[model samples]
Target: MMPNRRRENAIIGLGVIALAQVRSRKRKNFWIKNCLLNHDEECPMPLLPELQENNPDDFRNYLHMTDACFHQLFALLSPYIKKRDTCMRTAIPAEQRLIATLRYLATGRSLQDLKSTTGISPQALGLIIPETCSAIIQVLQKDYIPFPSNPQQWQDVAAQFQHQWDFPNCGGAIAGKHIRIVPPPNSGSDYLNYKGFCSIVMLAVVSATYEFLFLDVGKNGCNSDGGAIMQTEFYKRLQNGSLNLPPAEENVEGLNFVFVADEAFALGENILKPFPMRNLTPEQRIYNYRLSRARRVVENAFGIFSSRFRLFLTPINLAVYKLNHVVLCCCILHNFLLRNSSSYLASVSTDEDPAVSGPAEEAASRPSVGVMTGLEPGHAELPSQDAHDIQQKYLEYFVGKGAVPWQEIVADYLI
Candidate 1:
């Protein structure tokens, strides 16, 4: 009986060995089929020629190149970001995340698609996008993007305005644009209006070179530009004399010599507006025309931003917080490009021709009068007498200064 038991045990052991060998062989076969072999083993996969590949779609192309652009942008932004605990822990290594977000914004690609193409996990991608945008905005608002700091810079900018667009002593052009955003998760359909759906207001300031200097975001889509401005820290600074501004005598065009907005903004002592009244005198018409020519810089800047970051042109389906980051990131990239001349600015034309293919055409098409949509209706309606009074003030100011006639400058550029 003992000999019989031993023989049975040996037989069982042999059967187990046979089963293990079979499983090992199956695993090897699987690896071979999937081409997972090391260099010692030949891979039997076929190689395809590069030219034979199909042209990449816009999304793919954006993902491919944005990887590089974001890297450089983040490197410039890293030091300031590292200071914050939240930024340090969760920050999307600036280059990778920022580029990815820009690619998404520029192309309006799905987050899943971006994850697949960029190899960034969807969850990480989501977190990185907003964090990077916030970081970029902080960097731009703090260090890189300047807001007419000294009298010299303001004078230089004003000179550019006079020389390039024909308006003299203009500090910058200011305008407001509504960036379309997804309604809050629980909001009713009535909240979404004729502009499709939107959430934030972009109140931007553009330099004479058409560079975006200040981009303030996150105001409710329901709010007016004036409301947004009133609520901003920058506006508060302006109100409190924290922002060092040139004196009233140096005021160019009108309102303390600061070229602010056209009819969209309310006319004030510090902010310039076009001929406010319907019947304009010859001098007021010239000032209005010249101011229109100069103020187009901000309009062109917005146009360029929207056109290049096509995401702004479309409805953003991200969370409200994420949408704010997206807007800021786009603005940072816009300024970075303007400063470095390697980004979108290189492709833009500086020629005075209104027929240019990019932002110039968009700027030309925007209305010269009336309030921009997404504002409170009564907020923009200026009193006619006040408008006339403002116009008279500007005419008196311009004539007193003996500045070159605005029409000559406009004619030079238009011709």
Candidate 2:
């Protein structure tokens, strides 16, 4: 009877061992089928060749710039962002890293989508994108957006304005744009703009050539444009007369050389705005038209910039510090593309001849003016006597010898 019991227990133990083996085989086969390999060759991961093989238009559409521009940008950033391989993992090629970063900026795609398309893990991309942007700024900021350190440099900018917009003694066009962003936690409505979205103001001074000469970003969207500019270091320098700006005599007999801006900015000796159109002679109206013309350069700069880096088309979801780096990097990249004589710049002529129509009329007609749609008088002081005097001088210049041939016709047609 005891021998019979031991034999039965042995049989039960053997059956249990056989069942465990079968279950282990099933699990191993499931893992092999589902996770061991990619579904197909093409689905494995994206490669650089797949993007480059497409036509030029597709390349630009995908990367937001021409191959030449991408190559140039990659060259500038490669040294700083390159990585070395380790035993655990192979390093991503510099070209791949740059292309990935540009694709992210160009499309503003989700990291998951980017991971699938670029063959980068979302975890790695989370680290790579910001690092790439920081590397780009570190590499290009000095050469692309250098502050004018001499009177001659500022004069050259003024010369470009005179040749292009026919507004003399102008340094650069100044404006502010709201970069939409997702609000951080517990921050209240500090980032909420009048436009009913969270945003940060990107204040910039643009050259006639559509380059950003100076940029100050990350101001709260709720603040007025004038208030935002006051918070920048540039404002302090301007107030102290230490920004290497030309003397007041260089612009006109009595007026200081100035930047052209909208009415939201304060009227300062160094900044020129249009006369309020409330009650004006033909001369003041004409002066407003001319100033608006020069100011369009900065407006166009913002247009081209947002168009190129469509990331700005949607609200950025990064933290404030990261958004700052991204915005400044885009500004620098804009200048870089302009410097490189990109086809994008060539396609849109910045020097469009202002014929019979004044700049304000032309600006109103274009859809791009939506970028400057939110203009309002800021909490700035009233126009100073010197600023008014400068406006008067410019008004006289336009009505006098500086007038173009069609100015007389437009002047009569306007009022």
Candidate 3:
């Protein structure tokens, strides 16, 4: 009986050893599979946290905004983009999503590059950016870029133009910028511009403070500025006297108030363009200079905008409508920064092109014909009898009673 019991014990021991060996083999196989599938044992920590914690300058450089700005943005976006947790997996934090989107806008980095810097998968970003852009436009448009609803609001804008730019009765500066983008599937040269690239036009009316009062976007690259303006609802309303612009003020005796533009835009009662072709009169030249001075606000505004949001410098790889949303999102953010931050202008000069941020340096540069307002050529026609008379009246003022002290000095220099 003792011999039989000893033999049973030995068999039980061997069974236990075999079970242990099997479990060890399974553990080894699991690790090996994971190592093959993923290069590291766990995903690396995101780049933003480390920079934000240790190196602040790099953080601001990477995001193109201060930490306070980031917090402000996160607060604004949280209500719309915040995610709910579930049993199976945790949702990404709203802060993480905003950082990812801003990183894209600030750098215009490609998806693969962003994945490396941001640690967000390209697949996730593809969904996040467009949605975030849509949310920005949806949330910020009303308060940030609301059109002038009353005569007082319009007068307020004109007053700023007079105070800052020395131009009277000017509601806003109107211009356009080409937002480059890849061609959509099955699209022809409809997006091609004279510069030989695919683009969409962003025509905006800028206030004296460089805030965009109104925006018209999504026109094809081939659409001239004149055509784009003609197609807008703003144009229709202004033409029909429904835009609530202030009653024509006498900035100069009988001349009416108007928005200034380059010769690219068709002249109208509310729109003021410079005299076409070179003329012999000192007054016309002075009028052009003053008009150009006011108009440079839009150019500088675009320069600062493009410099602040580097996305405009790069061709966007989105559908046409998605591209429009992204541009609108950037414009709103620009205005938000202007409204909230006092140091933005000073800071932008250090980073952006001085031409846009430096209004003083722009004094010497005359408004040349066919300048870069994203307007196509061959669209402007001779001003109507009324439009020509308005231009004449303003010309008389610039060289006459309402003239600036330096108008003739600068006009003579130009001559």
Candidate with top TM-score is: 2
After aligning candidate 1 to the native by TM-score, how far in Å is the CA of 115 from where it should be? 2.6
Alpha-carbon deviation at 280 in model 2, angstroms:
2.2
**Over the stretch 321-363, how does candidate 3's per-residue lDDT look in tens digits?**
7788888899898898888766567633221122353434444
Give the clashing pairs for model 1: 70-95, 71-95, 181-198, 251-256, 251-257, 252-257
Off by over 4 Å in 1: 1-71, 77-98, 138-141, 149-152, 188-196, 250-255, 346-378, 381-390, 396-415
Q: Candidate 2: which stretches are off by over 4 Å?
A: 1-47, 50-54, 252-254, 346-352, 356-368, 371-376, 411-415
For model 3, what is the alpha-carbon lDDT of residue 305? 80
Where does the lowest 10-residue lDDT sum fall in candidate 3? 31-40
Cα lDDT of candidate 2 equals: 0.77
Q: How much is 186 displaced in model 2, in angstroms?
A: 0.9
Question: What is the model-wide C-alpha lDDT for candidate 1?
Answer: 0.61
* Candidate 1 vs candidate 2, lDDT winner: 2
Model 3 CA RMSD to the hidden true structure, in angstroms: 11.4
Pairs that clash in candidate 3? none
Name the 10 consecutive residues with the lowest summed lDDT in model 1.
43-52
Q: What is the lDDT of residue 21 in candidate 2?
A: 93
